[model samples]
Target: MQKKSLDAVLERLMTVFAVDSDSELARKLDVNRQTLGSWRSRQSIPYALCVNISEAEGVSLDWLLAGEGEMLRGGSISPTSKPAANPQEDAILALFRSLEETDRREIQSAAEEKKRIRDIEQRLEDLTEALAVARRPA
Candidate 1:
């Protein structure tokens, strides 16, 4: 199958979002900064990564990859609640929700590693508290 060219996708995304740098796009996509750099320089991105960014950012994949239509698939609609600082982030999250099992596993692995680090930090805090308690006057 013919893979979609990365430069085309990047250009469309840049135009749609009014962004100048891959870093900003990556931040919007919630992918590691380096990943965006790789996409920009190498002109390749994983399908999951593309989907991740597209969904999180609330971009239509058709527009993002092919430059076929409007930046917003549907026209502007008033948000009911305080909007996410980055509506695209909400799109990325929604994109993540639609991923396949294998793709989800990869994303989950990334998230789990971050969660594990947080858990370890919490445990360390608990230990520090216990040490403080032990040192308190009887």
Candidate 2:
């Protein structure tokens, strides 16, 4: 799957939490305000936190990461009960399940780096748009 922007993922998180500010998100996550600010400034999110939220709550990881599926899994499925994983997803899950703990940690680190870069790119894009708007005459 094509990687989604970190900013977009963050927006989805906000939608899930019904929050409009980072401070609120931080509070809901049980993290300090500075911690959240650090993550935003550094452009790196804690993958484990997202995973914990997904498992502890009923939220869907696919929707949080790639925005591919519904907001929730299991009981939140449609009336007919949509399948959780497609064939490709099934294959990936099988492989992922077989991996060593260290290997999984490596993959998680790589994902965090990718998300950091995506966040930076999104911030740059937003800044560029603001600049363009500022240059426009009244």
Candidate 3:
């Protein structure tokens, strides 16, 4: 199998996250350090992982995966420094940041639950199509 090229994307991630090494990047991405090394070795990053990172970090999916357009989505601020344009949004973000670790985990869990539901819905659609094809009068 050919190793996929991800040098540009990885470089951009390191720069954007202000990380010096892949281990640091892995920590920021909430992945095991070995997983980062494995990705580097395989030269492939999972699309779902990319999506999760994009959503969690407020980064643009296109920018994260293909390095196109701006690093962040419209109206989304970078976690490091950029402030939200709306004062209310800034205040909400500040409150979120001030939450305890357990509260933060709960919020993350809710987001993950939404992602799980979407995945399940897609899987159901796929299965329904397969079932229809299986029952076709051929």
Cα lDDT tens digits for candidate 3, 49-133: 7787788778888887776777677745568776547988788878876875346445655767799999999999999999999
Question: Candidate 3: where is the Cα deviation over 4 Å?
Answer: 1-4, 75-138
- How far does residue 135 in candidate 1 sit from its true spot (Å)? 47
lDDT of 2 by residue, 1-138 (tens): 122356666666765665667788788788998997777766767888889888876789987776676667663647566766689989876786577534544565566779999999999999999999999998
**Whole-model alpha-carbon lDDT for candidate 2:** 0.73
| CA RMSD of each candidate after superposition | 12.7, 13.9, 12.6
Answer with 2 or 3, whichever has the higher lDDT: 3
Q: State, as a TM-score between 0 and 1, how close model 3 is to the true structure.
A: 0.48
lDDT of each: 0.67, 0.73, 0.74
Off by over 4 Å in 1: 1-4, 75-138
Ranking of all candidate structures by their lDDT, best first: 3, 2, 1
Model 1 C-alpha lDDT per residue in residues 47-138, reported as the tens digit of each score: 77557667777777776766556555554556865465787888887897577434644665567779999999999999999999999999
Best by lDDT: 3
TM-score of each: 0.40, 0.50, 0.48
Lowest-lDDT window of 10 residues in candidate 3?
1-10
